[model samples]
Target chain A: MSTQASPETVAPRDGGDGGVPEPSPTAGRSGPRQRRSGGWFVLPFAVCFGLFMLWPVVHGIAMSFTDESLTLAGTSFVGFDNYVEAFGDAAVWNALGNTLFFTLITTVPLVLIALGMALLVHTGLAGQWLWRLAFFAPYLLPVAVVTLIWQWVYQPDLGLANQLLNALGFGPVGWLSDEAVAMWAIALLTVWWTVGFNFLLYLAALQSLPDTLYEAAALDGAGAWRRLWSITLPQLRRTTVLVGMLQVLASLKVFDQIYILTKGGPNDSTRPILEYIYDVGFTGYRLGYASAISYLFFALIIVVSIAQLRFFPRQEG
Target chain B: MTGAHPRRHDRFTVDRRRFLRLSLTASGAALAPGLLTGCGAPAPGGDGVGLKIWDLFSGGDGLLMDEMMDTVRGGPDGFTLDRTILEWGPSYYTKLAMAAAGGRAPDVAVLHLSRMPGYAPGGLLDPFDLELLAEFGITREDFPPALWERAQWEGRLYAVPLDTHPFIVFYDLDVAERAGVLDGAGRLIQPGSPGAMLETSAALAEAHGGAGLLFGHVTDPAQNWRIFNALYAQTGAAFDLPESGPAIDTDAAVRVVSFLQELFDGRTNPNHLDYFGALASFTESRGAMIAVGEWELPTLRSTGIRLGAAPFVNVFGEPAVATDSHSYVLPRQERPDPARRREAHRYVAAMLRQSLTWAGAGHLPAYQPVLAEPGYAELDPQSSYTEAGDLAVLDPPAWFAGSGSLFQDRMSQAIQPALLGRASAEAAVDRMVRECADLLDQPNPVR
Candidate 1:
């Protein structure tokens, strides 16, 4: 697959105005000759991908038009009925709203905090190794471990959060149970657990910037904040857009933490659309309905991803 | 009639034999991946039958089941059981359903009684033959009437019940005694009415430095439903089912929700404790009472806290308790071999006969012989609530109604806000009614 597709992948390169350096012009000559012999190499992966990933995507779409159930043997098509029901379903709307709200809540914090941590760590702080390790460690932990740790921390009665709050002369808060606070609690855990990935991204982007830019800014009679605004901020704009796009997509798919901590309640206050789809498909045995709702979510994600690409337009180097 | 085709049979017999051999080879080819991958172990081919069984039992229950398997291993019957333990709840059921649908389900699996309606109606389970079971020394008379009834669908038995775990009240015996809510024999003084139960909670809270009765309704709607169902059962209010939808007694629901809200007002009962948190609170002696199902028995017992069991408080008028049962079911297979089916039945019979061993985990055995065992009456908490078996009020027969089902989750969502004083009891009940109606209105594909 790589050999056959490599030519098409490289064909557009020749049309570009010298963006990529040509290490060897003769290297492309052998590509077509290897294509036929290499097909077998990709067979195994193609079979696996076809069976596991591609098949489910196709099967799920096919199922969305019917009244298929997990337990029932026979399925009959009822064109658009499941989709129609999803559109009218209040729970579906509630879950979608909650998911969007959660994305909005966490995306901003995740991006900003990650950038902040990256900047702080990049400034050559006294304990650079400790700061880097501390900022990136939580992401290395499994989601279940993160949720379990935070569950104890958020325990209403004797959790670490409440204990600390009480000692500070504040009242105990129902972090996992209160409808108003539950999603925020989940968002906070998510930020703490996941900001590491975004932080690492920003850190890499920060390190890759040439030191001469900062030196030139310093020579222009600028302060630290001015250097950051004029040079550092402008240089980091591409990474910021990339990080924001990734973070938004990740936040929209939140399920594990909420499932582990709240199971989408205190009254479905924290139930994101993925959980609602799980409930519909698996718990309710309405596979067709779940598929329809999922397809709707899939379409939304595609639209959002496309919209982001259009808005950002990949800054030209 | 036997010899009618004798003249033409020689060719037919040869053709039939050839067809059988061809199909067998084809099937072997189909099953090659399953044989190669360690997804599941192949049946041991020998004189003895190899039975594949799946269950979701873990922790104490898993240990007890393991002991029962050890006993089964030594039985006279030449049967070997290959056990697979899956994660409990929706995932377990989903895998079972998927395997059944694909015609590769295990010979036997454990199922919650409430899940039977969902599985049985969809051809996911096979009905048990009483006569076949009778040969193994098991009969209908061995189980309680309610459990036996629950195990059957359309007058055919689909599951052999292991035990019934009813919703019961567990109190910290030491705390209750200190609060003067215990009788002379160290048993909880039964609350004759809802008010009396609240008073007991109040007294216990005062004794425990203002910590009240703990129930895990904070986030789990299913737990909340168990408490609400038990309370509603006491009110003599039953759901009226019509083709259109379920007509629940709103008045009863409103009263029950309000009473629960009052209980969780944080004066006598803390309003914010989840399932595990509430159990920890009770064991830690911060709470005097916990209104939960019998499954939590082993957990409570392990706390080493002196605990006593009582019936769910009758807030309305009668002593009705919400309950669910665990039972053995044979998931339907595309081609079920008679040898394996017979072995599965024998295994179930053996498990049922050893219900006393199962009873140690705090489940009230559906097997009547276990109850009649001389030593069973000596079991502290089990004996204390054996009467709850007769009073068990099961979830209404709906595909959506069961442990870990969406019905319970939605109900909990509706009621939790009220329990936390975030929403009015009236609003909660209204939401519950609306959700129940929506669920009922949806077409049951299994039907």
Candidate 2:
């Protein structure tokens, strides 16, 4: 039963059930190990993981309950006050809108382009390494460097983009400078900077697909586009779901690029949720409120992740 | 070795909601709340009771500060030092606020003078005790009367005065003479009146080739707001009648906005950004005259560009300029001992005297005695515009108003539209007022 089917649904078999394993009274450590005397083995990692991740999450969760600040010594447990305030916060909705806007703009197109690049490079394309290298080289640059390079490119005056625009005698558009264009500008930057990773995943998936399906499709005269839509996509269903979820999660949490490039500016037009949390947590000095926003954000992300997980519903052999 | 089954003592700790809800179900401060985040490792040397200091100064100024700190460290002071340097802008304020709120705070720090008032009444800072401050050679007499006045809160000082770094108009003398905008003394023409400024700027623009309007530094709106504030002050307009709330809709602000708007007329530069290298080059016959802080004077001089410095053109009537003061502050320590506090005070004193040196970093020292010293009186741009302080100008006292740089946020929102001629002066002024109201409405409790 454990060998043939699902990885997700392994249930605990209780005593007396045919599947239940008999508990051995003395098989486990009744000695020093049983006493857990060597718990020190896990001590180092437990301390680190607890301190860094577990601690902040708990702290943030608690902070959401009060009128908390970095300035105040004592916090008043102003029940639901933080949530109530957030409900009224225009920035909350604005940031949500910006984040959602970014996700919509980048996610679909990223999957498509990444898949396209992968299919191109995977189907016995000439210069495959060069193409893969070209696609993958960008993903290796850290987020900050990617943002800096893209920022220079997107700069209104003296930027490559505007320089091209003016050279053509067209108007010099404020790519990142204009309020209406800022989000799109950032989304575009995000696509360029991140598509490489998704591309690589797609390429790997494409390579792993059996040649038999494509051979059959070719014999049946299924066009390249037809094969991609029918054979390639179905074969890549799992990879597609994984990549989509990863991009969605990563996109929702985007901070560094926006911070470096737009700084959520031109009237906070580019403000992202993470940036807002940073602002409220650090800048506004309203840690409690910031924590509320963060947890709300985390909850939102978790809900989305769960929905995606169930929506994809991985298939079993 | 003594580690238990490591059932993770930290995890499964009291949840915040459970705790807060418990307190709400029960009462306030009944239980001590340790709602802090990600306390990764205990700080290096966490147990030694070292004094921690945080600051956001970089470049030459940062180097100077480090040297000063080095001097303190090498001194016979008895305290061990732990320092953290944070990045500037919004990030800086956010971290500072978090550290302060989280209670694992630095023992000493620095804040802009204009920014301290906002922090005070909120009780983010433990106000400096006058008697304690006096023990450091800092008294009301040590700084200018007006600056000393700004440093106080409810008649008590919260931030000790450090230095005033105000904006100065940088002009290249060589380019000015070539553009025929220079005085007989080889200095760039000193425009005392608004009309003179426009005329000089126009001539320079024509001679240099142009964006024919005053270059508004849109990226740095805090400076822009100060520009408006100075003009408003010249017209006897205050930014806020705290009693009546922030009053940006006043006629004075409108007039200031209109005057600023008019600078975008074709006769002047309409570029929405200021480039120093461009302006310095222009002053050196590369571009044209530009308004910048006196800090750039050294760069201009080193460029071998002849330079001139002055208060921003007085738009409403009187000569007014945007000014801000930097100050050293002592944050509260958890377990304060007399000796460590005394050493911290010693560091403060040395810093204050060292401020004259800090002045060379383009600030006019707040310590007035430095002004009388030959070194200061002879200082270039500081000496030229030092008087801007007496009748001087500054941004409104708001937590949102200083180098953490949110000061630029809405003011740019308000003024950039007008300066770009997107909104008329009246509408822009109204918008600015509304934004101010909105900002005031933010119930951001200070840490």
Leading candidate by TM-score: 1
| Complex DockQ, candidate 2 | 0.26
User: What is the DockQ of the complex in model 1?
Assistant: 0.19
CA displacement after TM-score superposition, residue B297 of candidate 2 (Å): 4.2
What docking grade applies to model 2? Answer: acceptable
Query: Residue-wise lDDT of candidate 1 within B134-245, one digit each (tens)?
Result: 9999998888887898888889999998998889988877777889988888877777777887898898887777576788766765888888888888889996545578
Q: Can you give the lDDT of residue B230 in candidate 2?
A: 68
Most accurate candidate by lDDT: 1
Q: What is the C-alpha RMSD of each candidate to the true structure, in Å?
A: 11.5, 7.7
lDDT of 1 by residue, A161-280 (tens): 999999999998999888889999999999999998788777777777789988888898889999888888787776777577667867887788998888888778899988888777
- List, residue by residue over B43-135, the lDDT tens digit for candidate 2: 534455556677777655677677666766675643466666766677565555544444445667777777675567666665666776688
lDDT of candidates 1 onward, in order: 0.79, 0.65
Top candidate (DockQ): 2
Candidate 2: where is the Cα deviation over 4 Å? A1-55, A221-223, A314-317, B1-53, B67-84, B98-107, B129-136, B180-195, B211-216, B219-221, B241-244, B265-267, B274-286, B297-302, B405-407
For the second chain of model 2, what is the TM-score against the true structure's chain B?
0.80
